[model samples]
Target chain A: MPLSSSHRVSRRNLLKGAVALSALFAAPLIVSAPAAASAAAEQYVASIGKSILVVAGGSQGQMSGKFRNLMARHAAISAIGVFSLGKYRSKLPGSQKSEYYSLIEKFVAGLFVKYAPQFAGNRIEITGSKARSARDVIVSSKVHFASGKAPLEVQWRLLKAGSGFKIFDVRVLGVWLAIQQRTEFTSVIKRNKGDFGALLKFLRSK
Target chain B: MGVLFIDMVGMRDKGVTGLSRLLAAFCIVAATAIFIAPPSTLADGNRIVIQPVSDDGLDEIEEPGLDDPFEGVNRVIFALNDTVDQIVLRPVALVYRTVLPRPLRKGVANFLNHARTPVTLANDILQGDMKRAETTMVRFFLNTVAGFGGLRDIAGEAGWEYHSEDFGQTLATYGVPSGPYIVAPILGPSTPRHLVGRAVDILANPWTWILWDATTLESISPTLGETISARDDALETLDATREGSPDYYVTIKSLYRQNRESEVNNGAVLEEELPDIPDVR
Candidate 1:
């Protein structure tokens, strides 16, 4: 090892070249393997329907808890993005804004609990799925009520999150849920003279 | 009658013979010109014939924006309607849905739709659609005769389609612009043109005229029943929309505008081509 400096330098260069060549050959395989894995593991629109059925199966209080958990896991980003807090976004202090958002989540969860029971004992069949964009999918389903009434059409809008998809909105009978909430909330804010505090109070009260 | 028929036949022979002679002369002249054309000129004509036609002028023109001058006032009225729906209509519809059997509710809806046959027929005629008017008359007759006054839709079962038309659609077809979107109290969405159309339609409605001399309750019962049936049918959809929309007013406004536009265009617009107006919140 101590023989000649030139010999040692050439030997080090050879080792480095060998390592670089191996990395070049292995890089594409490493990248391709994960892409294939993710494609296989990607969540589908039907998964949201299955999750909703589970949440809808329970009692109101239990359903609320389950729905809240489901929302926390899937809808948190979409809720914040779509609710359109408007002036309240800047007017509300950070802590209060966070509180407002949390209250809204609970209120929405309560709404699901209130409505989901009506659909209990019903079969939710996923009919089809449509891709709205690279990141969004609309899953169509039919709710066959236990009373043998006409089936209701339901479409769940899902947004890609990480390797899976999360429900962002639901259209039942062609009416969108989030849009209605926005209208209601905006009306409340306007009535309260554009006071964020009042809006927060309203959410808290609910 | 015999003399008139003979005169009509004589007129037709004179007109047809004259038209045939004129067409024959035009064809002969055109053939002579084509045969006498030079080779270079003919090749140039062939080039023109083989050239691809430009479609720039034929592209679909985007529809103009709707008149919404009363948007502020309309929004207030919309809120009122929403409150009314939540407090009164929704609860009543929920009760109706829970209490009535599905088949009975369907029968009520069928009867209500059947009763409105005259309204649809009048609108069809006003829109100058004789085919649809005839279809409406036939459906009404068939349903009334075989379906026990439309408690059952026998014609519908037999594959005769039912269509709903209103004077508003007729007015639209006749170039009446929808003058300003307005959220009318009690009636919900309307425009000046539509409001006028509604008035005319109510006057023209045979059911209303028939029940005019009856008690107030008897006159209003059909309207009340239809409203309740429609609300009950839309319950899940309405509630779901309320739940899913970030700004209900904006979404609803857009949806209503799109619906009305489609109606006015006789559903010629492709769904994918519809603009998704974003919430203004």
Candidate 2:
């Protein structure tokens, strides 16, 4: 039953080769898990930046429609409304709240369309992104003007919702867009003596 | 003389002089030990020599008291600035915007920005940021040479980054507190620390020194041009803000504070944690 030296050496080599092959296959799976998760977050931020740049690239007349559709598809309009409403969210009925959100979303879309054309021909460069939490990521970008003006810093806050990500807010030159809107909305509500209907009427006029 | 020295040595060995010599030797050894001893061991060895003082008490006393305590005064100044803006700056800015073509205005702004590069470069050095200082110098050289007296913004076209640094930011880098918010007439929002920093900046500014040596009219014209051009540029945003906010003063104040803080922090803020201030009118 004593094996020849050549046969024994060949059998040992085969066993070693099998173990090495399995490690090679398993190494990537172990190493790539965390990396793949971070990559997904980065990809999500890049997509948001690309969408903004696309809207910014549109012609003056087409900007509003383009931005409105982009907002409808990619922005978390409901979450924004809730955040801006603050304590007032509890006071409004669910149906009225939904209506308010739609009106506000349309208003924002119109505003974006009006302003986006000004950035036409400008290059948007996505600088970097950082994960805020499991469900939130912040993307930083620079809007480089074609006229050789200084680039403006813009930050987008994206939140994970269901199977996709939605932009919850944006900050330009340190001023949070949603925060500014909330202040304005709250002021109007105060003037109307806490009447949400008056706020709705104001939004409608806009 | 040798016999006298021997006689003195014998006298010292038998009297107070010898005692004094022993004391001097002891003092020399003690001083050397004091100088050479490790500080930690010395503290334990000579408790009476080193007093035990707690820094915890000093920490509370020396903490910075630099927040917006003079809101009422600031609000009054802000109102004055607004009135001036309404009566003078706005109309002039409107005319400036409408009269000049967009490209022409951009050229003027670029030129003005180029002229101010030295100020930024100086502040960069004060902040101990040598990298930025080098960049600013390079930018200034490129713009002045290639952009034709900095009118064309050729440096920007070549992808040279523009940096705007002020003495206030330099002070912030050195851990100086903002020291209470104040809105100055014409100058708008500032803090006490910023006001002092501004004064230093004015002294450091090459333009100011140049103006000091130039004719009165020459001194006055550049400032006037800069003020008007800046106002013209900010016109759209300011008007939009005025129309968008019910309380315009509060909104501006809040925005100014937010902007300054962001500059101090170098624009680092967690997006998810960004305050949700609504933009709606």
Candidate 3:
């Protein structure tokens, strides 16, 4: 599903209170990009995640290499985040054997090239971000998609990472595509007698 | 603190207590009047209820006019509804349709057709049997998953079965008159009674039941997302159809009545009586 489809598929205020805490956690952050640029990058990555999930389900056609790169760029951030916050057991670490993770990497890398212009600008908007709990944060960003219509909603959840946070899950629309994929993967694996290789091949095949 | 607490206590005796007594007296009088009200008078008021029907035969009613004034409205609504459906839903359907890869779509549609026969059979088998309801419930769930979960493949193969029976139809089945036809903004062609029926079905759909079963945010997302997407698609079609007609209401009403009539009666089809397309070549 395209990230647009993710919005089609399915709140928070950390405010004056977070100013102190944000200052406390600020310096180690490697994001040299302005907050707006960083938000645009984040949105792109979330979109790529949605695209990979949609394509993996065998619901979409062979995307152009250009499109694939665009998807890869956006997806890379969270893929790395997943490995960084590596409590969850996933084949994402073994990208060589796991074609799923490999394709996902390509998907996000592709996205960065296509959305680089949007990222270059400092005018991106990130508004109404709030911490659901100490561990979970919901941030809603407004970014322009292809149509140049009103800004679309791209939201993500970041889980605690020692002092900072890592992207744990992102919801497009309301459906957590990652969770959905996981659920479907579990059922498919059980039904197929643990042959994830066959399932992956089938998913990746034309 | 002591002075404030004592002052609060003093005010409660004079104001809150007195108000509570007055409200209590009003409630007692209201309750007595309600109890004294005549059952016949209550029955005579405008209350809509589904009447029991014999299983042997369904009630028959006059067919809707093909050239009814509201035809324009019906067609417009359906067209707009179809537009939205095609735009939003077609993408999803196209994806699923590719995966299932028919001949399967037709095959699935056929399977559902045969499956429906048993619903009537069960109605007969149980002889208005509640036990049969259990079998029907099981069958309905299994088929719904197969039909909906596998929508494109199943529906494509099976052909569309507009099996939606609303409260209006239920009322009509039980000999209740269809009150004036009204066009709901996003809901499309509906009579006053059918509108009520739509409301009831919206609440009663299995999706809502599932939400009740698992009231987590996770469970709620997919169902709500799908519903809104589907509804948007349907409305999109209605909007397109409305744009085509000079008189939207006439076109929609005509189409709705014709569609409903066709549904009710297994009769010969009539040529569409609407005006020529203005823009399309």
Q: Compare the candidates by TM-score and give the number of the best one.
A: 2
DockQ of candidate 1 relative to the true structure = 0.04
Q: For residues B165-235, what per-residue lDDT tens digits would candidate 1 score against the true structure?
A: 77767877877555555566555665555555555556666665567566757766766676677777667
Relative to the true structure, candidate 2 reaches a TM of 0.71
Better of 1 and 3 by lDDT: 1
Off by over 4 Å in 1: A1-43, A76-83, A86-97, A117-121, A127-129, A191-194, B1-106, B117-149, B152-185, B200-206, B209-218, B228-281
Task: Report the C-alpha lDDT of model 1 over A20-115, residue by residue, as the tens digit.
Answer: 999999998766644443342233545656677777986665888888888888773434433444233344565665576678778888778757
Task: Give the B-chain TM-score of model 2.
Answer: 0.71
TM-score of each: 0.56, 0.71, 0.28
What lDDT score goes with residue B98 in model 1?
A: 91
* Local accuracy of candidate 3 as per-residue lDDT tens digits, B125-192: 33433553444454455555775543323332242322323334444444544444444333445554
lDDT (C-alpha) at residue A198 in model 1: 72
Ranking by lDDT: 2, 1, 3
- Top-DockQ structure, candidate number: 2
Angstrom error of the Cα, residue B267, model 1: value is 11
Estimate the Cα RMSD of every predicted model relative to the unseen true structure: 20.6, 20.8, 29.7
**C-alpha positional error of residue A201 in candidate 2 after TM-score superposition, expressed in Å:** 4.9
Error of 1 at B238 (Å): 9.3
